[model samples]
Target: MNIVVIGAGLTGANAVEELRNQGYAGDITLIGAEPHLPYERPPLSKGLLLGTAEPGSVFAHDHDWYADHQVDLRLGSPVTELDLGRRRVGVTGTQIAYDRLLLATGASPRRLPLAEPSNPDVVYLRTLDDALRLRARLTGHILIIGAGWIGLEVAAAARQADATVTVVEAGSLPLLGVLGPELAPLFVGLHREHGVDLRLSTTVDSLTGTQVDLSDGTRIHADTVLVGIGAKPEDQLAAQAGLATDNGVLVDARLRTSDPHVCAAGDVANHDHPRLRRLRVEHWDNAIQQGKHAARTMLGDDTPYVRQPYFFTDQYDLGMEYVGHVGHAGYDEVVIRGDADTRVLTAFWIRDNEVRAGMHLNDWDAIDPIRSLVEQGTTDLDALRDPEAALPVPSG
Candidate 1:
C-alpha cells in the first residue's frame, strides 16, 4: 500500500510514526512545506521566544529518524494540486500517487491590514523562523495587538527579555472570549503583575512608522509590533479536491473525509467529536492524538476518536492545563476551589448541574482527577468546589 501524508507538522509526523509503529509495511511519504523537521509549535511562543529552549529540542524526531525507518520524508515541498480522480498530488512539478492520503495541513496566522506593508518591525508568530526573527527583536519596546493566548504569551516572553511590552485588546479583559468575563480577569491581572502595559477596550486604528494609533485617540510608539489576533486553517487543498469544508475540512468520527481514501487531522480537520458534536481544535494534544487516531483508522481500526480535549499554556508564574469541550457549550455556573486571589485554584464549568470542563492554574496534581470528573459527568457542585473533597473513581 502507498500512503502520502500532505503535512510535516506535529500531526503529520505522528501519523507517519504511528503507521510504522503499528507494523504497516507500506510505502509512506511525508511531505512538509517547511524546510525543517516536524517540531512542536507550543514552544515557539513561550520557550523559543524567550531563548530558553534549544532549536532542536522542539522537533518531533531527529533528522536521521526518517531514513532509519525507511520513510520517504520530503521537505520544502508544497502540494499545489490534489487530483482525487487520479489518486495523486502535484508537488512542485512532481506527481506522487497514493492509495491513502492524510491531510494534516495546519493553520496560518491571520494577517492584519497595515498601512506600511514593508515595515520589517511588524511581525506575526507561526513557525520556527518567525520565532527566531521575533527573538532577535525582543530587546526594545514591543507592542502586541491582541489579548489572546499567543499575544499574552509573547508579552510574557518579551517582559522576561527586559523589553517594555504593551498589549492592546478590544475586549474589556484578556482572553474574554475563551475564558469568559469572570475568569478572563485572572489573566488580565497576571499580565499586569508582570509589568505589561495592558490597554483594554482598545483597538489599533493604524500603524505608521512605529507609531500605533488607537481607536480611543491615543498613540503608542513601538520598536516591534506582533499581531496575535488568531489563525485560519489551511484547508484550500482539501476544498479544491472536492472535500467537504466548513471553516475546515469536515471529517467523521473516524477522521475520514468525504472521500474514503482521504482523511484529515489536526487543525485542518473539522471532526465530528463524540461529546462535542462538530468542532475543530487547534492545540498540541489534539494534533498528536488525532494524528495517531487517523493513522489507526487507515489501518482498519474502527475505534472512534473520542479522546477528551486538552490544552495547556505557561505565562510568567501561571501554568494552566485545561481539559474539556466548552468552547461553544453554555455553562450555567463556575465552581472554584482554593483562592483566585492567590492565583492558585481549580475551576470547573458546570452545565445542567454536570461538570462539563475544568481548569487548574498553578496546580499540577488536579489534572487527572479533574479529567476524571469531566469524563464521569460529575454533578456534585459542593464536592467539586471543595478542595478537600475526594474525587470519585470511574466505574468499569
Candidate 2:
C-alpha cells in the first residue's frame, strides 16, 4: 500500500507518525512546501519571536525518527494538483500514485492590502521563516493590526522583549469574533497590564512607511507592523478535486472526505464534530488529536475522535485556557469567579444551566471540574460556579 500525506505542518507530521505506530507497513510519503522539516507552531510566535529558542529545538520529532520509520520525507515539494480519477497527485513535474491521501494543507497568514513596492517593515508571523524575520525587526514600537490570538501572543512576546506594542482591533473588543464579548475584556486588560497600547474599534486605511492611518483620523508611528487579522483555509485542492467544502474541506466524524480514500485534518478541515454537531475549529490541540484520529481511522480502526476541544495561550505571566465548545446562542448567562478588571479569574459560559465553555486567567486549578460538567451535560449552574461545592459524582 502506498500512502501520501500533504502539508508538513502539525497535522501532517502527526498523521504520518500515527500511521506507522498503528502497525502500517505501507510505503508512506510526506510532502512539505516549506524548506524546513515539521516544527511546532505555538513556539514560533513566543520563544522564536522573543529570541529565547535554543538551537535545533523545533522539530516535532528528530530527523532520525523518519529514517527509523522508513518514511519518505519530501521537503520543499508541494502538491500542485490532486487527480482523483488517476489516484495520483501532481507534484512539481511528477505524478505520485497513492492508495490513500491525507490533505493536511494548513492555513496561510492573512496579508494586508498594500500597494506595489511593499514596505520591508511590515511583518506577518506565521511560518518559521516569518518568525525569524520578525524577531530581528521587532526592536521597539511595533504595531499589530489585529487583536486575535496570534496578534496578542506576538504582542506578549514583544512586550517581554521590552518592545512597545500597540494592537488595533476593528471590533468593539479584542477576540470578540472568536471567544465573544463575554471573554474579550479579560484579554484587553491582560494586554494593558503588560504595557501594550490596545486600540479598539479602529480600522486601518493604509500603511505609509512607519505611520498607520486609521479611519478614525489617527496616525500611529510604528517601527514595524505585524498583521494577524485572520487565516483563510487552503481548501482549493479539496474543492477542486470535487470534494464537498464549506469554509474548509468538509470531513465526517471518521475524518473521511467526500472521497473515502481522501481525508483531511487540522486547521483546513471543517469536520462534523460529534458533540458540537458541526464545527470548523483551527485549534492546535484539535489538529494534533484529529490527525491522530484520522490516521487511526485510515488504518481500519473505527474509533471515533471523542476528545473535547482545548486550546491555551500565554500572555505576560498569565495563562489563558479554554475547553469544550460554545456557540453564540448557547451562552444565556455568564458566571465570573474572579475579578475581570484585575485579570485574575475564570468566566464560565452557561447554557441551559450547564457549563458549556469557560475562559480561565491564572485559574488552571478550576478547569477540570468545569470540563466534567460540560461533558456530563449537567445543568446545575449554581453548584458549578461555586468552587467549594462538591461536584456531582458520576454514576457507573
Candidate 3:
C-alpha cells in the first residue's frame, strides 16, 4: 500500500513509526514543510527557549532512522494540492499517489493583528527555528502578548535567562479560559513569584516601533515581543480536498475523515471523542496517542479512540499535569488536597459528585490516582479532599 502522511510533526512521525512497528510492509511517505526532521514542539517553549535542551534532543527520531526503516522522509516538501479522485498529492512540481493518507498537519501560532506584520524582533514560539531565534534575543526586556500557556512558559524561560519579562493578558487571570477563574490564580501566582511582570485585563492597542500602546492609556517599551495568543489548526489541505471541517478536520471515533481512505490525527483532527464528545486537542500526549490510534485504525483495527485528554506544563518551580476533560462551563466544585499557597496541591473538579478533571501542581505522584478517580467516577468528596485518602479500586 502507498501510505502518504501529509505532515512530519510528532503525530505524522509517530503514525509512520507505529505503522512500521505494527509490521506494515507498505510504502510510507512522510512529508514535512519544515526543513528539519520531525521534532517534539513542547520543548520549544520551555527547555529549548531556556537553552537547557539540545536542539537534536527534541526530534522524534534521528535523521538516519527513516532510511534504515525503509520509509520515505520528505523534508521541506509541502503538499500544495490534494486530488481526492486520483488519490494524488501535488507538491513542488511533483505528485505522489497514495492508497491511504493521514493528515497530521498540526497547528500554527496566531499572530497579533495590530502588531507589525514582519518585525525581526517579534517572535512566535511554534517551531525549533522560532525557539532558537527567541533564545538569542532573551537578553533584553521581553514583552509577551497573551497570558496563555505559551506566553507564560516563554515568560518563565525569559526570566530564567535574566531578561525582564512582562505578560499582557486581556483576561483577568492567566489560563482563565482553560483552567477557569478559580484555578487560574495559581498560574498567575507562579509567574509573579518568578519575577514576571503580569499585566492582566490589558489589551494592546497599537505597536509603535518597539513601544506597545495599551488600552489602559499606558505605553511600555520592549526590546522584543513574543505573541502567544493561541493557535489555529492547519486544516486547509483537508478542507480543499472536500473533507468536512469545522474547527479542524472532522473525524469519526476511529479517526476516519469524510473520505474512507483519508484519516487525521493530532491538532488538525476534530475527533468525535467518546468522553469529550466532538473536540480538538492540541497536546503532546494527544498527538502521540492519536497518531498510534490512527495507524491502528488504518491497519483494520476497529477499536475506538476513548482515552481521556491529558496535558502538562512546567514553569519555574511549578510543574503541572492535568487529566480528564472539563468544558468552558468550569467545574461544579474544586476540591483541594494540599495547600494552594504552599505551591503543592492537587485540585479535582467534581461534577455531579463525580470527578470530571484533576490537576496536580508540583505534585507529580498524584497523576495516577487522579486518573483512577476520573476513570472510576469516584464521588466521595471527603476522601478526595484528603491528601492521605487511598484511591478507590474500580468495581467490575
Candidate 4:
C-alpha cells in the first residue's frame, strides 16, 4: 500500500512516525511546503521569539531519521492539485498516486485588508520562516493588532527585548472567548504589568506607513507591525478535491474524511469530536495525538480519537495549561482554587456541577487533576474549587 502525507509540520511528522511504528512497510511520502524539516510551532511563539531556545531544537526528526525510516520526504514544493477520484496529487508538475492520503496541511495566518503583504513594515507569524523574519524586526517600537495568543506572546517577547510594544485588541481581554470573563482579567493584568501598552476594545483603523490609526482615534508609531488575529485552516486542496469542508476539511470521529481513502488531521481538520461536538483544535497536543490517531485509522484501527482538547501558554510570569472544551459564554460557573495574589491558581468552567473545562496558572502539577475533573464531575460541589481536595473528586 502507498501512503502519502500532505504537510511536514508536527502533525505530518508524527503521523509518518506512527505509520513506521505500526510496521507499515508500504511506500510512504511526506510532502511539505516549507524547506525546513518537520518542526514544532510552539517555540515559534514562545522560546524562539524569547531567544531562549535554539533554532534546531524545534524539529521533531533530523534529516537522517527520515532516510533511516525509508520515508520519501518532499520539501519546499506544495501539492497544488488533489484528484481523489483518480487517487493522484499534482506536486511540482508531477503526479503522485497514493492508496491512502493524509491531509495534515495545517493552517495559514489570518490576513487583514489593512495589513498588506506588500508592505515591508507589516508582518504575520505562522511558520519557521515567518518567525525568523519577525524575529529580526523585534526591535524598535512594535505595534501588534489583536490580543490573541500570538499577539500577547509577541508583546511579551518585545517587552523582554526592551522594545516599546503596543497591542490593540477589539475584545476587552486577551483570549476572552477561550478563557472567559472570570479568568480573563488575570491575563489583562499580566500584560499591563509587563509594560505592554495594551489597548482593549480597540482595533486598527488604518495601517499606513509606520503609523497605525486606531478606531478610538488614537495613533501609534511602529517600526514593526504584526497582525495576529488568528488563522484559517489550509484546506484549499481538500476543498478543490471535492472533499467536504467547513472552516476546515470535515472528518468523522476516527479522523476519516468524507472520502474513505482521504483523511485529515492537525489544524486543517474540523473533527466531529464525539463528546465536544464539531470543532477544530489548533494546538501542539492535538497535532501530536491526532496525527497518531489518524495514522491508526488509516491502518484499520476503529478506535475513536477520544482525547480531550488541551493547550498551554507561557507569558511573562504567567504559565497556563487548559484542558477540555468550553466557549466564550458557554459555562454557568467559574470556580477558582489556590491563591489569586501569588498567581498560583486552578480555575474550572462549570455548567450544572459538570466541569466542562479547567485551567491552572503557574501551577504545573495541577494539569492531571484538571483532566480528571473534566472526566469525572465532582461529588461534593465545594470540592470543585478546593486545591486541597483529592483528585477525581469521586462522582456519586
Candidate 5:
C-alpha cells in the first residue's frame, strides 16, 4: 500500500510508527513542512520555555528511525494540493499517489492584528523556534494578552525568571470559557498569588509600540508583549479538498473524512464523538491517541474512537490533569476532595447526577480513579463526594 501522511508533527510520526508496529510493510511517506524532525510542542510552554529542558529532548524520533523503518521522511516539503479525487497529494513540483492518506496537519497560534510583524518585541508562542526566542526575552516587564493556558503558562515562567508579568484577559476569570465559573477562581487565585498582575474583565484598546492602552483607560509600558490568545485548526487543505470543515475538518467516529480513503487526526480533526458532541481537541494526548486511531482505521479496524478529552497544564506550583468534556451543556455541581483553602484538591464536575468530567491539582493518586469515574460513569455520588471514601466508589 502506498500511504502518505501529511504533517510531521506528533500525530503523523506516531501514526507512521504504529503502522510499522502493526506489521504493515508498505511504502509509507511522511511529509513535513518544517525542516526539523517531528517534535513535541508541550515543552515550548513548559520546560523548554522555562530553560530547564535540553534543546534536543523534544523530538519525537531520532533521525535514523525513519530510515530504519523504511519510511520516506520528507522535511521542508509541504503539500500544496490535496487532490482527494485523484488520490494524490501535490508537494512542490511532484505528486505522490496514496492508497490511504492521513492529514495530521496541526494548528497555528492566532495572530494579533495590533502586533506588528516587523516588531521583535511583539510575539506569539507555537513552535520550538518561537519558544527559544521568547525564552531569552523573558526579562523586564512582560505584558501578555489572553489568560488562556498558553498565556497563564508564560506568565508563570516569566514570574519564575523574576520578570514582572501582567496578563490581560477579557473574561471575568482566567479560564472562564474552559473551566466555567465553578472552577475558574482556582486558576485566577493561582496566578495572582504568585505575583502575576492579572487584568481580568478587560481588553486591550490599542497597542502602540511597547505601550498598551486598555479598555479601562489604563496605560502600561511593556518590555515585551506575548499574545497567547488560543489557536485555530489548520484545515484549509481539507476545505479545499471539498471535505466538511467546521472549526476543523469534520471526521466520524472512526476518524474518517468525507472520503473513505482519507482520514484526519490531531488538532485538525473536528471529531464527531460518540459520547460528546462535535468537538476538536488540541492537546498532546488527543494527538497521540487519535493518530494511532486514524492509522488503525486505515487498516480496516471497525472500533470507534471513544476516548474522552484529556489535557494537562503546569503553572506556578499547580499541576492539573483533566478528563472528559462537559461541553456547552454545562455542569450542575462541582464536588471537591481536599483542602479547598490550600493549593491541593481533586474536583469533579457533575451533570445530571453523573460524573461528566473530573480534574486533580497536585494530587497524582486520584487520577486513575478519577479516570474510571469519568469513563465508566459512577452511581454513588455520596461516596464520590466524600474525600475519605475510596474512589470507584464501592458499588453494591
Candidate 6:
C-alpha cells in the first residue's frame, strides 16, 4: 500500500516514524511545504527566539533520517488540491497517487484586515520564516496585540532580547479565554515581573506607521507590532474534498475522515475523543499521539486514539503543566495544592468530587497521580486536598 501524509509539522513527522516503527513496509510519502526537514516548533518562540539553542537543534530528525526509513520525503512542495475521485493530490503542479492519505496540514497565522495595508511593520509568527523575519525586525519598543500563549511567549522572548515590550489584550485579563479569569493574572504577573507593559481590556483601533491608535483615544508608539490573535485550521482542502468540518476537518473517534481512505490529525483535524466524546484538542501531546494513532489505523490497526491531551509552557521561572480541559462547568471546586504567591502550586479542578483537570507549577511529582485520578474519574477530593495525604493510587 502507498501512504501519503501531508504537512511536516510534529504530527506528520511522528506519524511517519510511527508507521515505520509499526512495521509498515509499504511505500510512504511525506509532503511538507517548508524547505527545512521535520523540526520541533515549540522551541521557535522559546529557545530559538531567546538564542539559547542553535538553529539546527530543533529538528526532530536530520535529512538522512527519512531516506534511511525508506520514506519519500517531499520538502518544499505544497499540495494545492485534493482529488478524492482519483485518489490523487495536486502538489504544486504535479499530481501524486496515494492508496491512503493523511491530512496533517497544520494551521497558519491569521491576517488582520488592516486599514493601511501598506505598512510592512506588522508581523505574525507560525513558521521558521516568520520567526526569522520577526527576529530581524526586533528592535526597541515592541507592541504586541493579543495576550494568548503566543503573544505572552513572544513578549517573554522580546524582553529577553532587550526590547521594550507591551502586550494589549481585549479580554478582561490575559489568557482568560483559555486558562480562566482566576488564573489569567498569574500570567499577567509573569509578564509584569519581567517589565512587560501589559495592557489588558484594550483594543487597537488602527495602526499607522509606528503608532497604534487605541480605542480609548490614546496612541502608543511601537518599533514593531506583532499580532498573535490565534490561528484558524487549514481545512480548505479537506472541506473542498467534501469532508465534514467544524472548527477544523472533522473526523470520527478513529481519526478517520468522512472519506474512508482519508485520515486526519494535528491542529488541522478535529476528531472525536474516545473518552471525552465529541471533544477535539489542539495541544502538542494530542497532535503527536493522534498522529501516531492515525498512522496505525491506516496500517489496518483497529485501535482508537485514546491518549489524554497534555501541554506545557515555560515562561520566565514558571513551568506550567496541564492535563485535560480545566474548569469544566460540571467542576464545582478547585483544590489548590500550594500557595499561588509562592510561585509553586498545583490546581486540581474538581467536579462531582472527582478530579477533572490538573494544572501544576514546579510540581512534577503531583502530575502522575492527578492524571490517574482524572482518567479514572475516581479521585477522593478529601484525600487530594490534604497536603499530608500520600499521592493517590493509580486506578485500573
lDDT tens readout by residue for model 6, 254-291: 89999999999999988787766666666678778888
Task: Give the per-residue lDDT digits (tens) of candidate 2, residues 1-396.
Answer: 899998888898899999988889999999999988888888887777777785357778877898899889998997898989889988899999999999899888777886124788887778888888888887779999998899999999999889998888899998885567777777788789889999898989878887888878989899998889889889998899898999889988888899989888998888887877767777788879888888988887876676778888887787888878876566777777777666677777777776777767887786776566567766566665686765553452
| Per-residue C-alpha lDDT of model 1 across residues 192-270, encoded as one tens digit per residue | 9999999999998889878999998989999999999999999999988899999999999999999999999999999
Summarize candidate 5's per-residue lDDT along 84-193 as a digit string, tens digits.
Answer: 88999999999999999999999999988888789878999988889999999999999999999999999999999999999999989988766778779988888889
Error of 4 at 2 (Å): 0.4
Clashing residue pairs in candidate 5 are none
Give the CA lDDT, 0 to 100, for residue 59 in model 5: 96
Off by over 4 Å in 6: 115-118, 327-330
Tell me the TM-score of each prediction against the true structure: 0.97, 0.94, 0.97, 0.97, 0.98, 0.95
- Candidate 4, residues 1-396, lDDT tens digits: the string is 999999999999999999999999999999999999999999998899888987899999999999999999999989989999999989999999999999999999889888766899888899887888888888999999899989999999889989999999999888889888877888888888889888999988888887889999998889999999899999988988899999999999999999999889999999998878799999999999999999999999999897889999998878999999885338888888888777898888888677889889998998987888786754466756566875545443
TM-score, candidate 1, is 0.97
List ranges where model 5 is wrong by over 4 Å: 393-396
In candidate 1, which residue pairs get closer than 3 Å at backbone N, Cα or C atoms, i.e. clash? none
Candidate 2 ranges beyond 4 A from true positions: 115-117, 390-396
Over 4 Å off, model 4: 377-379, 386-388, 391-396
Model 5 accuracy (lDDT, Cα) = 0.91
Model 4 residue 188 lDDT? 85
> Candidate 4 versus the native: TM-score?
0.97
| Clash count, one per candidate | 0, 0, 0, 0, 0, 0
TM-score of 6: 0.95
RMSD in order of candidates: 1.2, 1.9, 1.3, 1.6, 1.3, 1.7
Where does model 1 exceed 4 Å of error? 393-396
Better of 2 and 3 by lDDT: 3
